[model samples]
Target: MRAALYFTPSRDSDLTLAAAEWLGRDPFTGESVVSDVSGSDGLVDAPRRYGFHGTLKAPFALADGKSLEQLEQAAAEFAASRCRFTVPELALGRLGSFFALVPARPCDALNAFAGDVVRHFEPFRAPLSDKDLERRRKSRLSPRQDALLCEWGYPYVFEEFRFHMTLTGSVPAEQFDDVEELLKTSFAAFTGKPLPIDALAVFVETEPGAAFQVQSRHLLVSAETEE
Candidate 1:
């Protein structure tokens, strides 16, 4: 099994509901959600398998002697140490041929928070296996990305990390406009709004090809509540 640290909104939040519907699966419950997007099940299958989330820590096997229970406890402590913050606005944007909700503008606080999550979980991550390394290399990574992959088990981290909640895998050039319009219409309620970064979720993949499911969620203490 492998576990990842990810940012997914509260189970009941509007964004979460919309994402579950659009992705056709809910990570929190491991249930299929119905949506009206044309060919949604097929169009989003790639991301649907992982559920709706932005990667904070890519999936990794636990380091020797580290247990899920231990990781959960450490995550809880980490969450407690953080104060809830927000991304001023999230806009629908294309990353290459894929579409995702991305921050409209960079936010230093969010970047710092993601960096901290990666570092804090480093000790719990087992070194990537040779097979894993080979697979990562197939992407033809740049020198810096290759170095980061060797050190962090993921090529994207710290400065290279770009937070994105993937909406679909690569869209066909001819269908891109239609799909983009469909996504915008479907997520119109929550896109381009301040997004709360209030919780961290532990998502687990039981086997190599299985879908990831939320194992637990830890909420950051709100400043008002902390006071």
Candidate 2:
């Protein structure tokens, strides 16, 4: 099994429910949701398996001597010690042929938060297997990213990470605009709003080809309370 750290809205939040329905799966519930988009299942096939979330720490196997229970406790501790914040604005965007919800501008707080999560969990992450290393190498990576992959098991973290909640696999270049419009309309109620970043979730993939599901959620405590 592999585990990842992600940010997802509260289980019963309207945005969470809408995203689950649009993606056709709910990581929180481990159930399928019907979508109205034509070929919706096929369009979101890639992200559906992972459900609706933005990764903070990419997935990795547990390091030797680490137990899932221990990891859960550590994650909960991390969450409880950190303060919650909000993303000022979220907008629909196309990253190449894929679509996602991304912040309108870079936020230092968001970047620092993600970097902390990566570093905090590093000790518990097993090194990437050879096959996984080679698979990452297939993509042309910058010198820094290659180094990050070697050291952290995932290339997109820290400075290279751009928080995005993926919505589609890869649409054709010609279909990008249409897909974006479709998603914009579908997610109108949730898009361009201030999104809360109040909790961190641990998600687990039971096997190589299985869908990842939420194993637990940790609420962020107020910074004032930590004093």
Candidate 3:
């Protein structure tokens, strides 16, 4: 099994519900959702497989004798030690060949938090297999990214990471505008609003090429909550 640390809205939040309908699958319940957007199912096939989330720590195999239970416990404890914060706002924008919800501006807290997650869980990550390394290399990674991959098992960590909640797979150039318009309409309610970063979600993929599902969500503890 492969596990990923990700940040997703609360299961019943408006943003989560809207994203579920747009992506055609609810990561929380692992159920199919009916979408109003034309061709949405095909458009979101890629992100739908992984579920909608901002990647915190990329999926990794549990190292050696480590088990899922241990990872969950560690995540819970880590979350409890951290304070909640909010992204000032998010905007729908093009990220390479796809569209996603990205922060409107730089967020130092979010970056630091993501970096901490990557380093904190490094112990649980198994070294990348040759096949994994080959696949990552196909991206023609820069020297710095290749170095990060060798050390961290995922190239996009720390400074290389760009937080995004994917909305579609690669859209053809001709269809980009139409797809972007559709996504904008679908996500209008939540876009441009401060998004709470209060929890860490653990997602699990039972086997290779299978759809990932949420295993659990650990809420961040605040002063009031701790009290």
Those runs of model 2 whose alpha carbons end farther than 4 Å from true positions after fitting are: 223-227
- TM-score of every candidate relative to the true structure: 0.97, 0.96, 0.98
Tens digits of per-residue lDDT, candidate 1, 1-227, equal 99999999989988889999899899999998877777565678889989899999999999999999999999999999999999999999999899999999998888999999999999999999999999999989999999999999999998899999999998888888899899989889877799999998999999988999999999999999999
- Candidate rank order under TM-score: 3, 1, 2
lDDT of 3 by residue, 100-142 (tens): 9999998998999999999999999999999999999999999
Question: What's each prediction's clash count?
Answer: 0, 0, 0
Model 1 misplaced regions, further than 4 Å:
none
RMSD of each: 1.0, 1.2, 1.0
Question: For model 2, how does the per-residue alpha-carbon lDDT over 79-165 read when each residue is reduced to its tens digit?
Answer: 988998889999887887889999888978888999999999999999998999999999888899999999999999888999999
* Ten-residue region with minimum lDDT total, candidate 1: 34-43
lDDT of each: 0.92, 0.89, 0.93
lDDT rank, highest first? 3, 1, 2
Question: Clashes in model 3: which pairs?
Answer: none
